[model samples]
Each structure stands twice: as structure tokens, then as C-alpha cells.
Target: MDFRFQSASPASWADVAADALVVVVTSQTQRKLEGALATLLKEAVAQGDFEFKAGRTLYMHRAAGVKAVRLVWVAAADESPKAARAAFAAAFGALKQGGTRHVAVAAAWEAGWQPAQAEALAAAAAEAAYVYRHTKPSAPKPAAWTKITVLGEKAEAKGVQEGLTRGAAISAGVTFARELANRPGNHCTPTVLAEEARALAEEYGLKVEVLDRKAVEKLGMGAFLAVARGSEEPLRFIVLRYDGAPRSKAPIVLVGKGITFDTGGISIKPAAEMDEMKFDMGGAASVLGTFRAIAELKPKLNLVGLIPACENMPDGKAVKPGDVVTSLSGQTIEILNTDAEGRLILCDALTYAERFKPAAVIDIATLTGACVIALGHHRSGLFSPDDELAAALQASGDKALDPCWRMPLDEEYDEALKSNFADVANVGGRAAGSVTAAMFLRKFTGKYRWAHLDIAGSAWKGGPAKGATGRPVPLLTHYLLDTAAAPSRA
Candidate 1:
């Protein structure tokens, strides 16, 4: 969909010749409404209707003197950023439901809304209108909106326009991430993921390389291979590099744990809800999604994305509990539980990342259920020994509204991974499971400043609204943008 900004007054918005004119209505906006629109809104409110509450919407059809077919009033409980995003989503939803082909949003920027908020609003609207029907029979098409015009003061036009552009790119990235995660494991195996990565690289003119099982073994990725051995699907270590900066620049490396379908191998998971393991690759999806955005935005920074794509199944060839495997970093690991396989694959990937001599490395994974229990579905668990990197990530999360709560990565947690037979143990018992998992990955990332995002919580949802949330893509993208915008390090 196309998005643009126009300079227009709220009273003049009705005459814009659009299918619908959407006006955000807050308690302040209710008193600020003037002329014919005010009278109509006041009358609607007087009739025990259109109370201003966050995300509430009231549609007026063919209102007197309004040229547009409908007027959409989206309520905002307060001027908070979250409320603004919710309001925009509600307004767009109203437009979609009313089958409005082209619409104008007369957003009340007077109510403490910044340009970034405007950008977020537009992005939220795009995201809300997204639907995934990849495998289902095609349904009758709904009336699609061809364009969205954000009506604002002349002074705000440039900022709003820039925001709209950035927001659209971010939203598209998010949607791509969701699509990758939503696919069934059968349809999106390790080989399929490599194909998708190659396609993305080709489309964006980025460098792409896919290392097959033989190449991965040649690199001594025993930890990753152990996890892949159980599955018939060929393992792929996919790398996508984007060098928007000079060759001398040190790149930021993102390592993603892509367990396409985790059946928990030897130490199997319960039968119930095991289907959701298709989403185990959420971290990899987010990385690819971030790549999609940066490719469009073209940030002036070198970036490298690594995805260790494979499956973990309970086949006879699967790695069993107490099995010892060597990692790409030459560290040996005693597998205490086959279910704790995310870190196993991630360890080898993170180890391989050292080849880039990255300034910083961040590995994203749906690694531990303990993270889900600790942070619930709201925030991801962040762990890093580097303070500067953690601070940058936290700030990015705040700006994107995709938050993470930092978890400890002390030597105490490292003690939990002690192994009698190997250099480290894969599972570190039940206590502080999330921290132990981070500690396990931390060992391989010693060559560079690194952080780990345990996204087991925020990757996807369960129940009736079950689907991928497309998280950390926003967080990671924002961080890259900020990094690119900053002055070069000496």
C-alpha cells in the first residue's frame, strides 16, 4: 500500500474526496473539534455513544456536509506512544472493514505526538491489516486500500513523510518474518530456509553462501551437526552479508538458532502442543526479517547474518543424552538433555562468527522454556557481558516497543555448566535454566563483545490468536540503524 502526507485541517479533511476520513478522537480532541464535524461528533457523543477510550472506534456514515462516505473516530485513552499505535491500528481496521479504497487520517498531532510516533502509527496500521493465508484455500478478496494519506500541518509533513517511509519498511520486514515463522516445518525445512535466504540475498543484491552438511562438517561444527544428524533434511549453514560501509569497517554479526522443527530428540517433548515447534526458528526469521529492512533502508554499516538451519528429531540417529560433541570453537559439550538443543546449534554458529572478527555478535534464539516462564510472553530475556551493547539493545527495544529485560550472566551461572566428561554441559539442571543457557552460549562468544536474546517468550503466541509475533526484528533493525548513524569507532 502507498502512504503519503498532506497538509490539511481537520475541518477540511471531509472534503478530501477520499472514501473515508479517519480522525483520532481523544478527550482533548472532542473539545477541539469545530464547525459541522464538531456538531455531528457532539450529537453522536450526546446519544450515549463514542466515548474516547483507547482503540475504540465509531463510524459515521454519510454525515451531513461531509464529502467522504464515512468518518472514522479512533479513541485514544492517553497520549502515550502505546496508545498512539493502538489508535492507528484501530483506525486502519475500521477502514478495512468499511471497504474504503483510499482514506485520509487526520491525526491530531497537537496531543503530544512526535514524528517517530507518527511513523510507528503508520507501521502499526500496516501490520494490523496483514493476514497470512499461505497454505489455505484462497478466500474471497476484501476491498483493499490503495493509499493512505496522513493529514497534518504543513510543518509536520516532512517528518511525517520520513516516518511513514521508515515505518513501512519496518512493517514489511516484520511481515516477512511472520510469514517465515508461520510456515509448517514440513514446508519450511533447513533446505527450504537456505533457499529462502538465497532468494532474499538475490532480491536485495546481498552476498549469500549456503554451507551444506559436508561443508559444515569440514568446518568442525560438531555441536550443530549432532542436532542435525537425527533429521533426514540436509543441514544448511546460511550466511548473508551486507556491506554498506567500507571494507575496513568491522561488521556486526547476528547469529540465529534455526531449529525448524524441534522434536527434542532422545529426550523428547510431550505430545501436546509439540506442533508449535515449527516456530523454533523464530530467531532466524527475525534475522532474515531485519536483513529485509536494512536492505531497503541501506544503512551505512557492515552487517553479517548467520543461520544454522537444521531439525532435531527423535530418530535412531539422533544425539542422545550424555553424548559428547565437539564444537566449532574446539570446546567439548556433554549433552545432558537432547531437548536443550538450541544452544548446541547456536554454539557452533557463534563460534564460526569469530571468522568475521566482528565488533559485536548477538545471537538470537528461542532457547529455553524457562525464559517463557520468567518473562512470560511480553519481553525477551537479554544476556550480555558487554554493557555498551546491552544498553544499545535496550534503548532500541524501548524505541520499537519490542522490549527485553536483561538477565544475569555471572560466573555463578557458568558454574552450573560444569561437566565431568566434557569441557561444558549442554543442560545445567533446572535452576536458572535461562541463565545457564546463556552462559553456555557465552563460552563460544569469547572472541568478541556479544549479547544473547532468549526469545522463547516473545516469538509467538498460543490459543485462538496463535501466530508468530515478528519480534526482535524491530529491535535488531533499530539497533543497526542507530549503529549506522553513529560516528565510526577508531
Candidate 2:
């Protein structure tokens, strides 16, 4: 969608010619006050039998004296961030439902919206308008509105333009992530994901490398190979480097688990909703999505994206229960369950990240179902050994509105992962399963500062709205942007 910014007020609706004009109203009585558009909106609110409440939207068709085809009034609860986001989403949703082709937004400044808030508004609009029809036999109907104009005061033009640019980048990233995750397992295999990464690199002028099975075997990635051995498709160790800073600077490394189709291997999951396992590669998708945004924004920081992409299928060659495998780091893991395979591939990737001597490493994975039980679908579970990194991530999540609850990663949780045959056991029983998974990966990340995002809960939804949510992308992007804005490290 195309977004344009205009320095206009609600009273100038007479001059704005569009399919729809959206204005914000704080409360029911606010419409009855002053302003030319206010009087018209008050009349419409009284005659059209509409109530003005937070997130409530009322529409009028070709209202008298208004040049637009429709006028929409969006209720704002207050000036708070959450309310503003909801209000924008509601207004955009209403416009979409009304089948308005072009829209003009005149409510962004109502709650004293700043650049950040404006960014949030545009992001929310893009998210609300997103629809996935890739699997359909034919393309879905075209979107009603192809362009959006945000009306702002003259003084806010620069900030609004910056916000719009940032918002568009983020929205595109989120949509890309969702598209990758929503594809069927057959269509979005490990090789396909690597190709997508390569395309992204080429388009954005980033450096790209794909390590095939032969190269992977040469590097002694036994843990990663164990998971890949079960699949007919070739494994791809995908790496994307964005060097916005000098080569001497230590980059931020991001490791993602790329299990394209997790069938739980020998330790199989139940047949019910098993198809949704295609979303198991959400972490990898988010990493690629973040790279898309970073390439567009060109944040002044070097970044490395590492994805251990493979499928986990059940086969005679698949790693069975009680199999012990040596990782690239020379750390042996006793795999009590093949279903716990995300960490297996990720552990080796984390070890490979050490070669970069990165200042920080963050791994994103749909690693555990237990995390869903712990945090549900509302928030992602964050685990980090370093308090500073944890605080930074939490702050980023909060600002982006993609919240994550910090989970405990105490040494005590490591007791459950002890194994007599190997250095560690893959599964740590049913108790604190999520924490144990983090602890298992923690062993390979000792060389660099690391954090783990257990996105099992927030990666996708179930039932009617069953699709990838493109989560934690906002959080990761915000963190990187904030890091880029900070003083350069020596």
C-alpha cells in the first residue's frame, strides 16, 4: 500500500478528495464541541445512531459538504500507546470493510502522537490490511484501498515522514515473515527458505552464503545433521551478513531454528493439528524478516543472521530416542527424544556463531510446546543468562508492543538435563520444560553474550485466526535500531 503524508486539519476535509476520510474522537461528548468537521460529525453521530467509544468506529456515506465518499470517526480511549495503536487499527479496519479505495487519516495528532507513535500507527494499519492467499488456486480479491494519506500539522511533517518510512519497513518485514511462515511445508522447505534468503540478499545488496549438506558435514555439525538425516530434502545452513559498520566491529549474531516441517521424528506428536508444525520454522522466518527491515533502514551496525534450516521427519535413519550425538562444539548430547530437535540444530549454530566473536548473540526458536503452556499465546518466553541483555530485550519488546516475559534460566534447571552418557541430555523431563530447553542451549553459548527467545507460544495462532503472527520481529528490530543509535563500542 502507498502511504502519503499531508499537512491538513480535520476542517480541511472539504478540500480532501478521497474514498474515505478518517477522524479521531476522544469521547462521545467531544464531537459536540467546536470545529467545522466536529459539528458535522456530531450531527452524524446523533442521526446515524452511533456511539463514540474507544476503538469504536462510525461511518457516514457522502456526508453533506464532505468531498470524500465516506467519513469515518474513530474513538480514542486516551493518548496512551496501546489505545492509539488500537484506534489506528480500528480505523484502518473500518476503511477496509467499507470498501474505500483511498483513505486520508486526520487523527494521528489527536493523542499528541509523536514519531514513534506515528510509526506504530502505520505499522498497525499495514498489519490489519494484510491477507495471505498464497495457497489459494487463484489470487484473492484485490484490496479496496491502495493508498493512505496521514494528515498532520506542518511542524510534524519531518517526524511524520520518518515515522512513515520506519513503519513501512517494519510492516513489510512483518508481512514477509508471515508469508514465509504461512506457506505449506511442501512449498516452504529448507531449500526454499534458503533461496528466499538469497533473493532477499540480492535485492538488498547484503552478503549471502548457503552451506549445503556437504559443507555442513565437513564442519562436523553432527547435532544438526542428526535432525537433517531424517528428511529427503537437503539441509541448508543459511548465513546473511549486513555490514553497515566497519569490518573490525563485532557484529550482533542472530541464530534461528529452521525446522521447515517438524513431524516430531521418531518421538512423534499427535496427529491432531500436526499440520501446523509447518510453522516450526517461524524463528528462521523472523530472522529473514528482520534482515529485510535492516537492509531497508540500513542501521549503522553490522549484523549476522544464521539459520540452521532442515526438516525433522520420521525415518529409519532418523536419530532415535536415546541416541547420543557430538556437536560442532565437541559437546555431546544424549537425545532422549527426537521431537526435541530444534535445540539440537540450534546448539551447533550457536557454536558456529563463536567464529564471528560477536558482541552478542540471540537465538529465536519454536523450541518447546511447554513454553506455550507456560506463557500461552499472549507473549514469547525470553531466557538470558545476562541481566543486561535481558533488560535491553524487555525494554525493546515493551516499546514495540511485542511483549516477552522473562523466564528463569537458573543453574538449578540444568540438573534435569544431566546425562551419564553425554555432556547433556536433550530433554529434561516434563518439569520446567521450557527453562530446561534454554539451559540446554546455554551450554553452547558460553563464548558470547546470548539470549534465547522461546517463540513457541507467539509464533502462530490456532483455530479461526490460524496463521503466523510474525511476532518478536518488532522486538528484534527495535533492539537493533536502538543498538545502532547508541555510541559505537570500542
Candidate 3:
């Protein structure tokens, strides 16, 4: 989708045309407004009988307010455009419910609020208005909404506009990741996932490095390689780097579990929707999508993404229960259940990332079904050793509206993975299953401040598949941007 922004004077708003219409107005009751669009709206209200309730959207035969653009109301505050856009979206969403297709917004001018900020609010509202449209074969086409005009003053609002643009672009990237997650195993394989990553790299400015099966073997990624033995297709480890910050900036590292399809190897999964294994690589797609956004935003932060892409098929060569494998970090892992494949691949990748001496490391994965059972679909499970790092991520997620809930990473969870044959066991019984999985990955993180995001429930579309919901891309982007904007240890 393409986005465009235009700047025009208040009088030019009347000529602004669109399919759906939103007329900015003062309060529905008799109240003289004294904010940004005060003069223009005061004059327009006296000239006509237009009714605008706080939460209601009214259609206009002629453009109302100073700009003559479709208008929404901000009660009194001069810097109330953000609130006004919210009102506009509420009314506009209602119009869509009422069968309206397109919407044009006209706003009353504000002296206090920067136009850029107002535009950002407008873009945010529009982006939030997004509804997944991939499912429902008979669903109606979405109505077109193209233009938004703010009335009154025309000061430079470049900063606000840039923010809104960044948010919307990052949202688009998240949706891309979700789409990959929603695909069926038959349609999305490790090979295919690599292709998708390459495409994204080409479109953005990120650098891509892919290590094939032989290369992975040479690197001694035995645990990851063991999991890949089940699939006929060769495996590939994808590494992406985006450095927009000064060369001196410490690079932040992101790792993802790219199990494109998981049939549980020798420990076969239940028959029900095993096909949905296509989404197993949702974590990899997410970080890749995030890199796309970071490339565009050009934040002054050094970053690297590690994705170990493979399929967990149940073939003769597949690693079976009781198998022991060594990781790139020189740690041995006992395979208690072949189904626990995500961590196997991710452990090696995390060990690999330690070479960069990253300022911080974050790994995302659909690692355990137990996570879904624990958090349901409401939130992703966050596990981190560093409190400050966890707090920053949680705060960033909250601001981006992609919330995360912290999961414990006490030594108790680590003990669960204790293995008689190896340093650790891949599966840690049914109790605290998610935490144990996180613990297994922690062994490879070394001294880096690491956080694990188990996106089992958040990675795909649960309710309906109108399109991919793109769960945590925005949250991850928000976190990265925050870190890039301000340096923090751990």
C-alpha cells in the first residue's frame, strides 16, 4: 500500500475530495470552541446547521469548518488534534459499519499542536483502523480513505508526520511477518522462507548472509543440524545486519527460530492442524520484518539478526528421543522430545551471535505450545535475566500496543533441563515448560543481556485469517527504536 501526504491552506480544504466524508465540528451541544480550529469553526457553525456529537460522525453536503474539508471536533484544547483523530476514527468506523466506503477528514486548526503531530495522530488512527481482510470469502471490499486536511495554521509539522509514517511503515512490515506465519507448512518451507528474507533485504537496505547445510555443518551447529536431518530440503542459517548508527555504536542482536515446518521429527505431533507448522518460522519472519523497518527509519543503532531456518520432518534420519547433540557453544543437549526443535536451532544461533559482543540480544520464537497454553492469545511470554532490559522492552511494547508479560527465569527452571547424558535436556517435563525452554537458550547467551520472546500465541492469526495479524513486529520495532534513540546497558 502507498501513503501520501499533502499540505494546503484552510480554504483549500473545500476542494479536497474522497469517497467517505468526515466533517470536523464543535461539540454537539451549544458550546463555543476556543482551540486550534476556533476561528474557522466558529464562523462555519454560524453559517450552517451541522450537528457533531463527541463520538458521532456526521456526513456533510458541503465541506464544513475553516478548511471546508470534512471535519471532526476537538472540544477546547489547542493541541487536541490527536483526540480529534480518535473521534474521527470512531465516527469513521461507524460509517463503515453503516456501509460507507471512503472517508475524508477536515480538522479545525490548533495554535498549540504542531501540524506534524496532528498528521501523525491521523496516520496512527488510520493504521489502527486496519482490519485483517484475508478470511471471509464474501467480505465486502474495504472502503477507500485517502486524504486528511487540518484546518487553521500551517506551521511545519515534519517531525510529527515522520513519526506517523514510521509507525505505519513498521506496521506493514509486521503484517508481512504474520502472513508468513499464517501460511500452511506445504506452502512455506525453509527454502521458501530464505527467499522471502532475500526479497525483504532487496527492498530494504539490510545486508543478508545465508549459510547452507555444508556451511552449518562446518560451523559445528550439531543440535540445529540434528533437527534438520529430518527434512529432505537442505537447511540454511540466515544472518541479516543493519547498521544505521555510527560505527562506534554497540550492535544489538536479534535471533529467531525459523522452523519453517515442524512435524516433530521422530516425536510426531498430533494430526490436528499439524499443517499449521508453516507458522513455526513466524519468529524469523518477525525479526526480518523488523530489520526492514529499521532500515527505513535509519536509527543510529547497530543491529544484527540471526535466523536458523529448517524443517522438522519425521524421516529415518530424524533425531529421535534420547539423542544427544552438541551445540555451536560447545554445550551438549539431550533430545527428550524431537518436538522441541525451535530451541535446538536457536541455541546455536545465539551462540553464534556472541561473537559480535552485542550490547543486547533478543530472541523470538514459537518455541512451545506450552506457552500458548499459559498465555493464551492475549500476550507473548517475555523472559530475561536483566530486569532493566525486561522493563524497557515491556514499556516499549506497552507504548506500541503489542503487550508482553514477563515470565520467570529462576534457577529452578534451569534445573529442570538437567540431563544425565548431556549438559542439558531439550524438554523439561510438562511443568514450567515454557520457562525451561527459555532456560535452555540462556545457556548460550553468555555475558550478553538477553531476552526471549515466546510468541507461540501471538505469532499467528487465531480468531480469523482475514490476513496475518503480525503480532510483535511493532513492539520489537518500538523497542529497537527506543534503544537506538537512547543508549542503555542491558
Looking at model 3, residue 461 earns an lDDT score of 56
Q: Which candidate is the best by TM-score?
A: 1
Q: What's the TM for model 3?
A: 0.81
Error of 1 at 208 (Å): 0.4
TM-score on alpha carbons, each prediction = 0.97, 0.96, 0.81
Q: Which stretches of candidate 3 lie over 4 Å from their true place?
A: 1-16, 23-103, 106-156
Instruction: Give the higher-lDDT candidate: 1 or 3.
Output: 1
- Alpha carbon lDDT of residue 59, candidate 2? 74
Candidate 2 residue pairs in backbone clash: none
Better of 2 and 3 by TM-score: 2
Q: lDDT score of model 3?
A: 0.73
> Mind giving the per-residue lDDT tens digits that candidate 2 earns over 107-151?
634444477767877787888788888887575554577787877
Candidate 1's C-alpha lDDT?
Answer: 0.87
| Alpha-carbon deviation at 42 in model 1, angstroms | 1.2
